[model samples]
Target: MTRIASYCIAASALFLLAPSAALAQEGEATPPPAPEGQAAAAAAPAAAPAQAAPAKAEPKEDLKDKPAPNSIYAEGLGAGLWYSINYERRVIDDLGVRVGFSYISIGATVSAGNSSSSASASLLTFPITASYLGVRSGKHALEVGGGVSVTYATAQASNSFGSSASGSGVGAYGSAMVGYRLHPVDGAGFNFRVGAMALIGPGFNVFGDDPTAFGVLPFGYISLGASF
Candidate 1:
């Protein structure tokens, strides 16, 4: 009976030891599953940095191939009972050519003690000019040019001294002008300018030159005009 008890104790001990040995082997052999929270945290930090990289690279495309504003102009001028037709074409941003035709006339009459005199003068002038124009901003501009003018003038006088005089002349002149331009509206608008010009050169008489010889003369012009 004692031997039978000893054998039974040994079998119980073997069974207990077997379970401990198996548990130790399993602990050393198998790996644990990764922690879900830790893995997700690591992945989120990496993804954030990757997403932020694209935003820094996006602005380079926006700065490429940008365009500029349009800079071009066309203008004209006219004035008074003495009228002028002028055209300006811009060759560059601030330089241009001015071309124009002008017409002028004047008449006078006097009487003293039944003696009467009448006088009249008419002129047609054409100017071809090149100009340098400057506009620092919108609505204001300055212009200067030197030009050649061809003028055809006719004068007639009838006096009480029993003399009637008529004269016609053709003149070649050079002139310079400076002016300001004001624009009040948008592109489809008007511009007004005021300026003074000096004309000086020689003339030839076609008829009636005995009393007044045609030669170099100084003439001046004052003008106000608008452009549309």
Candidate 2:
């Protein structure tokens, strides 16, 4: 009976110690809880760098093609009956004024009964005009304008007998023109023009008795020059 009681006491003490050892081992195996802020930072991904916006581009200016503002040219059968040298200047973008000059002279000598006579005659023409240029397309444009012409004539005669005579006259006429023009758009270069013109004036008789009569005449001209 004594041996059986001692065995029971030892078995009970082992059962209590076994349960406490098992609880300590379980506690050591599990980790402690982390702080809330630290846990959130670890779980979330890093933010990407902020991106900059692209810059806007500005528009460029247009380079328009245009003719030069001044020109000098020789014209045939327009302002002058034969030819004239003309200079033109643009007061505005598309408006221009021109002035030109032309001249002609005649001379003759006559011998009659020992009394010789010599005579000379001269004509001077001045043309002044204002014109407008049309819209340019490439290197070409349409030109139109009108103006006036002034003519001065003089005659002188002297005989071997010492008799002398002289006369002079001034006349004015109206004129107009329409034509195509080719010129340099950017700089100095060759320029050309072709057009028709009309002149209204009094017809003058160089040899006949009647010196002035009303008349209208149609003419044409071709011009070549340099533009700047």
Candidate 3:
């Protein structure tokens, strides 16, 4: 009976010690508590990512008022020291007006029945004409014009017949001309033209009689010009 009582006491002591051992193991397994501030920081939602400012668009350049397409032409011709200048203007496409001016002087000898006469003359003429542009295309054209002219002439003659004479006269003339023109593509390029002209005057000839000034006055010319 004494041995049995000692065994029961030992069993009771083991039961109390076993409970203390289990509680210590549980405490060791548990994590440490965080600070209040740290806990709040961890639980709060993350701040929204900062938005980027919109980029300012740069201002564009202002370009306006370009040049227009157009041209200016000048024409010129000459024979020896005598020369002419002409210009044409179009009031309507394919039809236009032409005007020109020239100066000339010549000396000649006339022989008739042993009477030899030395004659000299100087003349200035201005022609105003209206033209039709019959054919015009890319770089070439055909043109015709008819008009009147104004002339002023001075002449002096001395002959073996013992006669000397000097005279000055102003005359009106009827005239016609035709032309071929070449237009250049470049703004400052050379333009070319060729043409024939004839004239008739009602008064005494500026050169001589019989043949008359108009009889041998038909002439051809070549010109060079420029376009703007």
* Top candidate, metric lDDT: 2
Give me the overall lDDT of model 2.
0.85
Candidate 2 RMSD to the correct structure: 9.4
Error of 1 at 54 (Å): 20
lDDT, candidates in the order shown: 0.59, 0.85, 0.66
RMSD of each: 10.6, 9.4, 14.5
Score candidate 3 by lDDT.
0.66
What ranges in model 3 sit over 4 Å off?
1-83, 107-119, 157-164, 184-188, 202-209, 213-218
- The sequence of per-residue lDDT tens digits that candidate 1 reaches over residues 1-228 is 999999999999999899899999998899776799987887775644445345454445321221111222322232211455666565654566666777778999999997999999998877776666564345566756667767789999999888999999886667666776553323434545556554434332234464244533323334433433
- The regions of model 2 sitting more than 4 angstroms off are 1-64, 204-211
Ranking by TM-score: 2, 3, 1
Q: Per-residue lDDT for 1-228 in model 3, tens only?
A: 999999999999999999899989988998688999999999999999999999999977322211112223333432211455666555555566766778889999989897898999998877676767647765576867767767789999999978999999987777667888665433345567678866555532556756454443665556665643
Candidate 2 lDDT by residue in tens digits, 1-228: 899999999999999899899989988998677899999999999999999989888876433465678999999889877788899987876788989998989999999898899999998999998878866686788889889989999999999989999999998888889999887777788989899988877773333455576566778888999999
TM-score of each: 0.45, 0.65, 0.48
Candidates 1 and 2 compared by TM-score, better number: 2
